[model samples]
Target: MSSQQSIRQQYGTVQANALKLDEEKAKQSVDALNTDLANAYVLYHQLRKHHWNVDGAEYDQLHDWFGDAAEDAETAADEMAERVAALGGVPVSGPAALESHATVDFEGEDVYDARTSLENDLETYGDVIEAVREHVTVAENLGDYATSEVLRDHLAELEADADDLRGFLADDTLVLESAMH
Candidate 1:
């Protein structure tokens, strides 16, 4: 046999052995990915709702922020699904599956007030960022550096976006306080 074939065979054996030895870790990773994907999907829906329903003095700004947040959540959902498939697991799909796996709560009513919608977004985004940070720690412990790195980047972006929204909401107050000092 060719050297390439020999290497492939050896790698296959190694994978088989690793699977046998660490099946539980792989299962844990899959479960984490499924849960994260579900949370991302729910968050995506919430952001979409906020994008569509927000109205107030800051309607345009809130609308655009919600859209950007939804896009990021969608990207994270896709990435999680891809990672699940890459690890020899089937990606979870369907509304029921997402509902079953999601830890984030979805808002039932459409928020008409822009401030209320923005506050909701800020709260949910913070929760998801915290979860993602914990997941990154778990992935790092598992020596899954790629997953850890991806999650780290995603979490950072989410936190930064949340901070921006919070900052916007407090801009007037902050400016006033700064002038007084």
Candidate 2:
């Protein structure tokens, strides 16, 4: 086995940042950002799964939308990770830590219909939107306006994605019934 990597900074250890935010308060925002980061990754994978498995009369549209949403989730996760690091705390990494920190639930290995998948995505988006809104407040309360602003921008994009999912669900053009005998 190769040599293990040395730790530069340990998790939960907050250092002084150039932003001049209080180190103690920055810890709170860092913790929230890590949690958000984990949730974003969960959403990212779920979106990718739906994108790959989506099928139906609206397959083309849903597939493309899922791909876009997955990109958004990935981009949001990257930004949150950077924010956590900027706050002087080591961002949470690894599957175990991410799963433990994440409040969002995974959709698992089962493949459902396009409508069911879109509904699931909507639910996940709702959960993420709510959590992000709360975390924005947390950052603002702790005087971390930069983090709050970042989350606010992500929140708007997330809401727009969720609305797209809602629209996909609203369309009644999908063939939900099987005619094969």
Candidate 3:
């Protein structure tokens, strides 16, 4: 490990009841939330990838929508990590760590078909939702109400994202004839 790594690892020990939470339970909640943070990071980048590369007659609209979703993911990740820190735990910060810790995987092609792209995005959202729900219970069981509340809100947001994507996919009134011109 580098000197910086040694320093951070050495003094990074979490203290109990720093945030008025049970130290052990807070640490447990933080551990679970670190995984949530990492997965959110993965989903943020994946959403951005689709936002930047998706192609279709509706490229502009989808790109804009995905960009907003990516921003939301980024915010969620940052907030989750901040909560971990607030709970006196170290958030997983390295890309490799984040990737290994993430439950969601990136599977969309560099170029994507519209419905497939939407479906892939929904899958990513769904994966995060599942993880979020699991970790929310962890937080609640630990009496980490702040963390639990944040995660509950995140769950709602993810569901809205999925519902939005599913709605677009279900819309059959799309007309692409004019775009072929």
* Model 3 ranges off by over 4 Å: 1-6, 9-13, 176-181
Candidate 2, after superposition: displacement of residue 111 in Å? Answer: 1.0
* Model 1: per-residue Cα lDDT at residue 72: 91
Candidate 1 local Cα displacement, residue 5, angstroms: 35
Which candidate's TM-score is highest?
2
In lDDT terms, how accurate is model 1?
A: 0.74
Clashing residue pairs in candidate 2 (N, C-alpha, C atoms within 3 angstroms): none
lDDT of 1 by residue, 136-156 (tens): 888878876766777787787
TM-score of candidate 1 against the unseen true structure: 0.80
Residue-wise lDDT of candidate 3 within 42-147, one digit each (tens)? Answer: 8888888888887878889889999999999888888888888888888888888888888888774476777787888888888899999999888888888899
Which scores higher on lDDT, 2 or 3?
A: 2
lDDT of each: 0.74, 0.89, 0.83
Per-candidate TM-score against the hidden true structure: 0.80, 0.92, 0.88
Per-residue CA lDDT of model 2 for 118-170, tens digit only, reads 89989999999999999999999998899999999999999999988888777
* Models, CA RMSD each: 9.1, 2.1, 2.6
TM-score of 3: 0.88
lDDT of 1 at 115: 62
